[model samples]
Target: MNDARPPLPAPPRPVRRAAAALALAAVAGSAQATDVFRLEGFGAVSRSMGGVATAQDVGPAGMMTNPATLSLLQAGHTLMGGLDLVTTDIEVQDQATGARVSSGHHGSNRGPYVAPELAYAQRVGAWTFGVGAFAQGGLGTEYGSSSFLSRATGGLDTGLDNSSRLLVLNIPLAASFKVNEALTVGAGIDAMWQGLNLNLLLGADQVGSLIGASRVSGALLPVLGGLPDLRGAHFSLTRNSPLASGINAWGHAERIGMTYQLRPDTRLGAAFTTRSHMADMEGRATLTAVDGVAGQIPLNGNLKIRDFQMPAVLNLGVSHTVSERLQVAADLSRVFWSRVMKDIKVGFVSDGGGDLNILLPQDYKDQNVLAVGAAYQWDARWTWRGGFRIADQALRGSTLFAVIPATPRKHLSAGFGYAVSPAASVDLAWSHAFREHLDNTSLPNTSAPIGVNHAQDNATIAFTWRF
Candidate 1:
């Protein structure tokens, strides 16, 4: 019989979780796990080493990294796939000693990673057309143990040890049109989803504005076998906050970009992705315990809602060919995290219309990212490339992140591609992040708070194809 080798599927996942988790962990700590962590920048195979330079000549994947780059396609078909192994170990703050509470009290996420892309561009006269699909951005984290959440909320004071779970997902589709020899335009739409899980804290408020009586008929505490007097006194505060509800549904983000060729060897590109919005979530939370072991907490207090709008980003990039076989590219981008920081609002649709609100740290600092990379050819089938990124300040001032204190981050990356036959090439890349865990510590009533610090390290790999 003749030898036979069936075709294998694409890479396992295009999203690099190691880099994703590093970026997310660097975004915040245990307390504010939901808001601080963000998953973007997929297809690490390309952006991993450079500041996303391929955006110009990059076709399918370019829709995600740089849609404007679609105009630079040399008239052909292409496919790109990759995997991201992201693992995280996050710690909550210890209120008493101002130390990491417990390593077990952490957030770890994995799976649901697959980024596939396909692009075809043909020059019909002077105009070009292309379409592509990519995972774009999304991530998930399951934190704390079941016992942790129950224990934390059962006590009179639940530090930050309550169990927490979070998940987010995204898929975007993009298309481009070449208007002329030097000008191209493109647009995209992102379908995204998010979810979070949190337990009840014993005393949130005094129910000062509530209409019902403070005391109910039953024992605020519980009954334990053999210990009749063990069931002590417990209090129930008013669930007046409107942000405690659960959110489950779908939303979208918009992307638009333009690319133009300069004087011959030089090219420039720019783009903007609109913000994302998630409405209120619906769920229940109750205080469960036994004699001296539990309290009468309200699980289904009222309605809770939260919205995290990804900041609108601005990107500017320029690429220049130095010689026949040598080319270099650079990119500068901004993430406007300050927009939804403090101004973010959540309302109750079922309630009779009351003002139930809390103050979020609106002092989110601006973020800047700079990248530079170049490609070199040793022969017709071999090419080499590398790049780096210097990120802006991610953490604001004190009170910025009490439960979770994200740190400033920087990355060092490199990659290489090998041509297969005449129409295909495989790409490989690696990136490492060196982060300085800032001081993030707070006391129950410390007039002047203390600082808790930490650090991070991670790596990634990817592949690309051209036909």
Candidate 2:
């Protein structure tokens, strides 16, 4: 009976250094939201108008929507800063056993996620230049160690953690040029960052099913499959740090847009944003396995996340001033989610020998969004704004939906703007996503029924300075 084990392999120097940098640079909050992991809007003004910034001037925030709107800025240096506070309510239930778990309940506090935005733009001659940082969007959930999802052998709580988090940030350099009295064109480039963390526990049957569908390599599969009575076996992956994601990556993207003046008081706008090109995310993970024959085995490994990227987006909009104090705007957008979110591939190479690859299917569909808004001038120093948005769900009903529940369908918003002085102003907005419910009867390996419900509330405040 030999019980000795070989020493684990060490990651390359570059991977180690990059992982260290990511750990140090990671932020505390996560961004998850309305448009199936994407926020409905970028700033207070845009949000107040149902994210209809394509044809209207929303100040520096336009860099994220339609850069062509930058040409409508007042001729001076303009700076804007904004913060969004989001609170989400998620509930999960085991339809067969009647066991339930809810986010922000039973000691889990995953609400009040903070996302910030900053932008500065300058208008000189016939050109406008802008630079800004924006928290794009992602999906996250946390079910503590005591939840039914953490149950293992003999239906006993294993105290295993089940959680997932993803965050994306974008920094853009944009410029708009006024070609003529009736048209303006704009272009921009974005430096993107993405982070992912996962802590999952899978039963032996689930693991076997994944192995059957996954792209298997290395010499370890033979030994793992030779074991007898795998009914009590389980596999788990845990992160090394709580503050940072287990894996992170960087990427780049480009966008182009234009605004056309249809009439003296009417405008049309359009924008195209390309998909991101990201590198594979790398980090360290702790892999643990428990089996009826092999007992419990713990191994250290390097984890790699492959082919994770954001989808391309196309936006079209119109804005019209009906009277001196009344304005209206409308926008339509298409998100190509099917192209990038079909499947997520993860590979783990243990230190001792061999590697394992797993493919998680998301089967996300393309999403379409429609938004409409109106604004009214109440007085010389006050303005009122209201908006509504509707979007189709991106995920199909399946077990995957229970793991990542981001399926809100309708949103309503209202806000107001106040002029503090001739050179400064403040905007505030609030939005709510109606509750959505989905039942999961498409479990891959098991016949467990699951139900998920999700809803959200968000508030944004922004300040602008003109000099």
Per-residue error for 83 in candidate 1, Å, reads 2.2
Give per-residue CA lDDT, model 1, range 293-343, as digits (tens).
Answer: 443322223434466656677878887877544556777778777775543
- Summed backbone clashes in each candidate are 21, 2
Root mean square deviation (Cα) for candidate 1: 10.5
Q: What is the C-alpha RMSD of each candidate to the true structure, in Å?
A: 10.5, 15.2
List the candidates' TM-scores in order: 0.67, 0.88
* Candidate 1 worst ten-residue window by lDDT: 202-211
Q: lDDT of each prediction vs. the true structure? A: 0.46, 0.75
Tens-place lDDT digits, model 2, residues 255-367:
99999999999999999999899999888886666565555566688889898989999999999987655678888999899999887787888888778777767889998
